[model samples]
Target: MMAEKEVQLPILRSVYQDLTRSEQRIADYITSHADEIMDKTIPELARNTKSAEITISRFCKKLGFSGLQGLKIALAAELSSSGDDRFQDIHRGDSYEQVAGKIFGNIAEGMQDTLKILDYAAVERAINALVQARRVAVYGFGNSATVCRDIETRFLRFGMVVQAYDDISQQLTSASLLTAEDVVIAVSHSGSTMNLLKTVEVAKKSGAKIIVITSYAQSNLAKIGDIVLTGMGREVHYRSESVASRLIHMAITDVLYTGIAMQQPEQYQENIGKMRSVISATRE
Candidate 1:
């Protein structure tokens, strides 16, 4: 299947809270009147939003566009793209089967969207960092903590020295100790979690590589990321705060794990065999 064209509306939505007052005003106008954006020139947009042309241009650049024209092009592409919203809301008195189908369908579409936006080069950089790092640390809180633990579980099988931290203090402490030879995988769905951002900032100052797995490519955490893996999972009415994004993040973890294994097949195989034997013995 062909990948969908890159969409910018979601990026605006994700970063809306982080934008400055003037930028937010521009975003509000563009997002609310997306269909009319193409027909208007830069001056018209600026005048309509009650902002200067330069402010609008700056806003576009902040969202990773070159200028207003680039933003318009992206808006046009998104407007013309063909796709229906797959995430259905869970209404009261809905049948069990109907609810099940809706949930499953949304998750499937979310994954598909992730695959479409998944940057292979970024994935390769992350895998290389993980493989070569003297130590690896993962940071996540709330829903993202599960993905962090999954990272630890998968990398440990490959005999990699990795730890996952869910607590803010622990995350900060771990970040402070990381060296140039270390890597940090920071997971966040919103990508704007203040505590996680602070921890990642510490990790950044320690000269360790930061690999951010988040849905927002332009988030503050992503700005600090040496390698950014973007996932596209929209917040639906039923699944508030990106509950669906956790699964998408976990899928990314699996991709990284498989890639790391491929880099050294025989060594990974040997480690897997040893780990499986010891764990099997413990289970029974």
Candidate 2:
């Protein structure tokens, strides 16, 4: 397996069809006036797009940032690479302060939007699967590969033996040792990562139950897995939510982790209190 830092981030193809009409319009607008919109604050951007702030935040999350700051970083990143201001006019008429509310609005909406389609049953079922697994191999690549790593840590709290493999070879080797006794969870927004798909195929061939978490259940990666959980929507280049996709993914993780913890009520309560204590201490 290649070193973690050496792993390449997959270049995502435009999942444009996955977006709603308004989101598509926003995306088109961004693409058309990339130089102009990059300069606007969240509210200004919202005004230009004729979308609410909430919608804008959700739009940013879809592209994988946590909040507006992240979106700006992405824009800055875009600018750093292109050395051009693509957002000259998108928020041209607005003041920085007026744009802030819409920015918050976009973030608030992104949070709600992600939860709107979350699959509760699948989360429970995944918990049950994890609770029973002898071992698990989590997979994804590029931007999503780390989420698999994050999920691995979540499984560890329940005391399940887990491994997250991003390399094609390591994942294949891990699959060779599995049986129906194990579970494999794969995450990809596009569900088309070749490395991810290959390992999933290997695990399936080895009689393991495969679970796929992605944005599109209709994707090939979702089809191969025995169970699929979807958590994605339209792309509007909104940049309001900053990083809503990770928030949504984190929420899904939160639910799955809670469901697993709840399976043992006493442990769940104890763990919750302990967790709260730690968090409370951090508040100081």
Candidate 3:
């Protein structure tokens, strides 16, 4: 199936944090005057946003468009659509059903928005690296640690020599042992965790390949990564949790796990059979 096209306004909103100041100005202009943006030329848009023409072009490309024309087409389509199902807040005093609906809706939207920006080429590269590596180490911190643990659990069933590190000290120690034959999957949502970066740097010096899963592809973590997978989402009010970044990271890692399985179907089947046999014996 063909990939779904990203909606202009929602993409602009989702990736706002990663944009430069000039790009933010352009985004603000487009979002506020979306209906009128189609009528204006690129030069006119640059003038209106107090940015250069090239800046407008970069802004358009940053939003996954070819250029101004592509952005305009998406904007026009959004304008023509009947409803605005953009990000919404979960209000207080709502009934149980209302809250549940908003949470589920936001999670689904987060995944779809993430799909819009996912780099398929990078994903393939990551799978190849994992499949060939002599060892794999997954690292993350705080809320991200849960994702790391989940990856550890899933990849083990495939019989890959992988470990998850949530503690910075343990991560640094592990990094020191990685070799060029290994791969490191680092999860940092903001991509600005100093300790995580330090650990990754150590791994890089040891010559391990880096695969970064983060919200901002422009983040320092992404900069040094061999392959970068970005996840996008805006924070909702009330819970204010990053529904997008958290879930999307898990989703991408799951995709990697599945890809590795597909690459070694016979091995995967054998490993799964052995694992199931042991687990089944423990059941009543």
Candidate 4:
């Protein structure tokens, strides 16, 4: 449950088992001497680790760094911190109060980091795409599908045409019908979901602009996206059970929703009033 900002060591550890032998060696050397790694050039580190410079660069990208310098800068920042105690992972014997504090602290930290790294320009671009599109189709599976449904509900309130699909068959059918005037918001934390990728491919063929929300900047999903918004957070040990990612996803969705609302305030207000009146009548 470490804060996303202090991600250098945690990211390496999180994906260590998936790294190649050479990458593992590089990761080991860097983690052990993180402070010094910043001072050394990529070639120098390559020599030290007996890895080629290209290998070092590839390893950095695998961890979502732009290059060696980016990796070094992140490492330096993480190593300088004494580590936030509240963000520590939960223990077996922790009290309920301790668990609550840790969970809240971790979520807060992740949101802060996500905000810090968010590309406002890209967000604006995404908003523009959504606003200009003839239709907006949201695609996601599992927990991400819940996020997609939330987005659909928000856009629907604005009187916009939006559809969210949780089933792969329905997603493919919806995607196949999209055109260049449409926009697709594909939500996948890992960005490697094959089913989502397949749907995206079909959508792309019809010239739909893709907006991907994921944690990995260099993931396959990002590669295909017209605008890629990165969600900052490391999935804890019980990744499937973690709420941190869902929180981050909702935060990003909030930004987009507000952006669209602000762009057309008069229409948004009118739609909101109508929706409220209709819902209130149901309650009565």
Candidate 5:
């Protein structure tokens, strides 16, 4: 039996299972052009196979990929020598909009990678612990600080007492002060921020709940975390915000927030009102 993490191509699930004629045709085309399809556009592939765009999309989803684009991208990676680019050419001749869209695409891919490596049972345990924690502390450095602030702001609506630490001294101080009943969510893309990890260590020995969100495996942060959520990337380009890594972190945060909300309905509603009250007052 294949593990969930090992299951990449959904299309290979069953040879005898039902498939629409159009889907079968599209799948055949993918198998034929498995080499060139990696960089092919949706319109181009559809045209080549005489298949409609929607049919191709459904075929991809039927195979377990989120869309046709994802399936092709994966297949392309398989054919390419390295399937990894240390640098991106998309920035060379692109407009700002083009750059922005490409960045978003990267983030989406990064998030998907993170999801693939994540342990759902850990997320569940973290969510339960957080919901019952006496307080929550969030810490980060650089762009990660923004992610920390964002998650903290959302967590506050549940009326959970939340704090964000940006300064090392302050974070350390707070970490030392936290009790076993408190939860700390630390954010770092590289997962190697010395200050953040130090703070996490302090929190750890103190018995505080530790959730580590980062982009590296075998990372020290991952080693200490009670829960490690990854943000993945490829070569050719270092993990840049304009591409996949940022979106991956953004997705993980959103998923955690959504889980918290769904796990505690009354608390979620109360948190919603806290945001609404500010808008209501602004209108007044």
Candidate 6:
């Protein structure tokens, strides 16, 4: 059986435009010579790229690796594969079909990679918290707020008490009202949104358990989460938020929703039926 391939290089290229000049230099050098980089030490790489060792280490972390060694290992694994031509970025001069293919391909690959790194134990813990909580509050800002709303709608179908707050002040107020019996699901792609972080801080103080859905595990928000679920994706340039990341977040939400429904099939089925009946009555 063939080993699964890592998506490091493709992820690097996807976020290349967002990297600082020094980080870009290191990324370019490593990408262009994956095999060579695997053999070189961090100091060697920094010297070769004319960048500082600390800069190289930061670059590695930015790509979701723990450090230089982790980056090299992932690079070696990826290089050993047939290579990832599917994740190539969409270019300006591409035809409609080409653009569609690239976008679809990137999303597919991202979902696959996300599955590889998913911490099922953490997911189960999060589901348990949601199942037992008296109330659930979803907090997010910007594009992440949309994800929070989507989660709210899905959970509501199961007859769960859920609230989604997009406004900063409202989120703070809602979080402050949460108690030990409540749960907070905070979504942030960057995991460093100050407003969202502030709300989470308040929620934590109120003794509400926090479940974070974010891209980086090492982020401050993730540190505060009682249970952290990561949504990994290649962020493309020119977009304010990661399209692929949103899909992963939704996928995780679907898993939690389905798992909860399965825990009590009869009651969940009844809830769905009643919800559908109410909607149908409104239409008539």
TM-scores, all candidates, are 0.82, 0.59, 0.89, 0.84, 0.65, 0.78
The sequence of per-residue lDDT tens digits that candidate 5 reaches over residues 58-173 is 77676557986678666655445324422243646779897676666655444444555566787788788888899999999888888888888877777789989899999999
Clashes in predicted model 3: 0
Question: How does model 1 fare in lDDT?
Answer: 0.84
Each prediction's total of clashing residue pairs, residues at least 3 apart in sequence or on different chains, is 0, 29, 0, 0, 14, 0
Write one digit per residue (lDDT tens) for candidate 3, span 12-52: 75567779999988887777777678789989999999999
- What's the distance in Å from true for residue 210, model 1? 1.8
Best candidate per TM-score, number? 3
- Worst ten in a row by lDDT for model 5: 4-13
Clashing pairs in 6: none
lDDT on C-alpha atoms for all candidate structures:
0.84, 0.67, 0.84, 0.82, 0.71, 0.81
Runs of candidate 4 exceeding 4 Å displacement: 1-28, 57-86, 238-243
Per-residue lDDT, model 1, residue 268, is 93
TM-score of model 4 relative to the true fold?
0.84
Candidate 3: C-alpha lDDT: 0.84
Error of 4 at 216 (Å): 1.9
lDDT of 5: 0.71
Q: Kindly list the per-residue Cα lDDT of model 4 for residues 166-209, writing each as its tens digit.
A: 99999999999999999999998778899999999999998999
* Candidate with the larger TM-score of 2 and 5: 5
Candidate 1 per-residue lDDT over residues 54-103, each given as its tens digit: 89888888877898788888677666662555447788788999888888
Rate residue 123 of model 2 by lDDT: 74
